[model samples]
Target chain A: MKKNFKLYISLFLTTLKISAFTFGGGFVIVSLMRKEFVQKRKWLTEQEMLNYTALAQSSPGAVAINTSILVGHHIGGFLGSIVTVLAAALPPLVIISIISLFYNLIRENLIVSYILMGMQAGVAAVLCDVIMGLSASVWRESKTFALAVMILTFLSLALLSINIIFVIVACAVAGVIYFGKIGKKGLKNDLS
Target chain B: MIYLELFWAFFQIGLFSIGGGYAALPLIQQQIVNNYGWLTVSEFADLIIIAESTPGPIALNAATFVGTRVAGFAGAVIATIGFIAPSAVIIALLLFLYNRYKNLKYVNDALRGLRPAVVGFIAAAALTILKLTFFSESAATVGLVNIASLIIFTLALIALRKFKIKPIMVLIGSGILGLVIYGGLSLI
Candidate 1:
């Protein structure tokens, strides 16, 4: 009982700390979470972190909290997942609530506006970095095919201004058609 | 009635907000600003800044902010739950089905295509924010590009990419740079 409680506390606290301190976005918190769980505690392997991060990204909802739930489950079962999620979510809930209360006082301040403006620009660059990393991974698999899809997707969203929902659905359908033929069995053969 | 609309709107956004927080921006902009008129376009842009700088997911922060605006505390609670429900359900399903179904070609293929498309969305989101940050509404008529914002952008990009700084550090550094540039200039 004591050991189980200890595990739960650590899981909760660690998630809380990462969620509270880390800023920018889900992807940024991800690296910190991996360092703590996979590197420091050895609760999960490197491959598992990579797998869950990818899962979190591709799955719906908040990637940071989703990942905490994933790793928490991997560690402490369903109960662990619940604990970790609450821990991950609580800090933000509280922080934003405070900000909401002070919204008017802060919103019109010239200094606050300037800082926010600066942060937005910085965030744009961060998002661009993520794009480069994501594209590189996609390109490494099937260069020409992935490149074509990425270019098409970017242009549609950026220039044509297509609805995001349609863009995602069309890409998913294309994935099913194109990749349905090339299963791992065939992929294995190709590698050899 | 507004609460019900808030619930449904956020629930849909949460369900569809794939590719992480940035992709959620366009959806939130559409629903909250364009669809319901809860916040003006400029207000939505400021909300994005708040959402990004604050902890947690952008969607969660958004749900809370919009909910509070529409219906106070209860609205915040309902909207947050609505936003989280699909994600919780989906993640739980993925967790359970993950090992058994991971290698299926359709699964792999769907992800393969979805992956790049998601990146494209993130890129689009960045461009959108870039426009929001740098271009003023008056720019259409006056063409007043904020030079201070341009300087901050270049400095921030250099700090992030060249020096390999952490994001929080970059944020703080930008704040200081903002105070120095914009604060000083406004006084002039």
Candidate 2:
């Protein structure tokens, strides 16, 4: 019992540190987690971490949160998952809460708006990098089908201005049908 | 009633944000900005800046920020919970099934399909932010272009793609540049 309690506390603290410090996005957090859990603590094997990451990415919600929950579950079961999630979530909650409280004051300031305008451009560039990286990876894996889907989805959303929820659902159904047909054959081809 | 609305809106965001944090941007924009008018387009961009520079998940940060903006501390608590509720339930069930089955062929296949589409979703989001950044107002007209913003965007992109500077650093650099350039202009 004492050992279990210690594990949970360490899990909470490690995740809290990771959540509080890592910047960028979900993938950054995942890599940091790999360093901590697989390399530092030896709590998880490489294969286990990889599997959990893939599952976390595919399942839904914030990948960082999902990955943390899975890691916690592996180490400490349900209670562990809860602890890690709280640890992961608490920083953003507190930080953003403080920011939002001062949001009006910040928004009304001319200098701040100028800074935000500059930051906005930076944000767009970062997002563009993300889009390019994601699309390139998709294009590499599936080629035409993936490219076509990406372009079509972009056009529909950007030009046609369709409701985003509809686009997601349509893609999901399309994915099931398309991938289901390819099935084992596709997997085999990818291995080669 | 407002609390319930916040929960439902964010619950749907949690449930549908399939790819990751970036994937959730469009959904949050649709619900919070477009549907509810909780935030304007420019404010949404600021939220993105804030979410990225700060730690933790972008979706989680956005939920907390938007919630706080709409309803204060309690709303922040509620929205944050609502955003994670689906993730909590879904992940638990997935973990259980994953342990039992040991294979996830169908899930992998669906992800294969969803992955490209998620790229599309994110691209659309980038376009929206880019449009707002570059053009003064309407995208079609391309009315007064913000040359300073364009310069910052180009430099930031080059810095990211070529120099491999961290995004947080790039954001900070851009903000300082903004102060020097824009603040200097205002002085004149």
Q: Using lDDT as the measure, which candidate wins?
A: 2
* Per-residue lDDT of candidate 1, residues A74-103 (tens digit): 999999989988898777677777777788
What shift in Å separates residue A121 of candidate 1 from its native position after superposition? 3.4
lDDT of each: 0.79, 0.88
- State the lDDT at A64 in candidate 1: 90
Q: What is the interface RMSD of candidate 2, in Å?
A: 1.1
Docking class of 1: medium
Clash list (residue pairs), candidate 1: none
B40 in model 2: Cα distance from truth in Å? 0.8
Can you write out model 2's per-residue Cα lDDT over B42-142, one digit (the tens) per residue?
Answer: 88998999998899889999999999989998899899999999988988788878889988777777778888988888888898899898885321123
Regions more than 4 Å wrong, model 2: A184-192, B137-143
Q: Score the docking of each candidate (DockQ).
A: 0.62, 0.81
Worst 10 residues of 2 chain A by lDDT: A177-186
Q: Please give me the DockQ of candidate 2 compared with the native complex.
A: 0.81
TM-score of every model? 0.84, 0.94
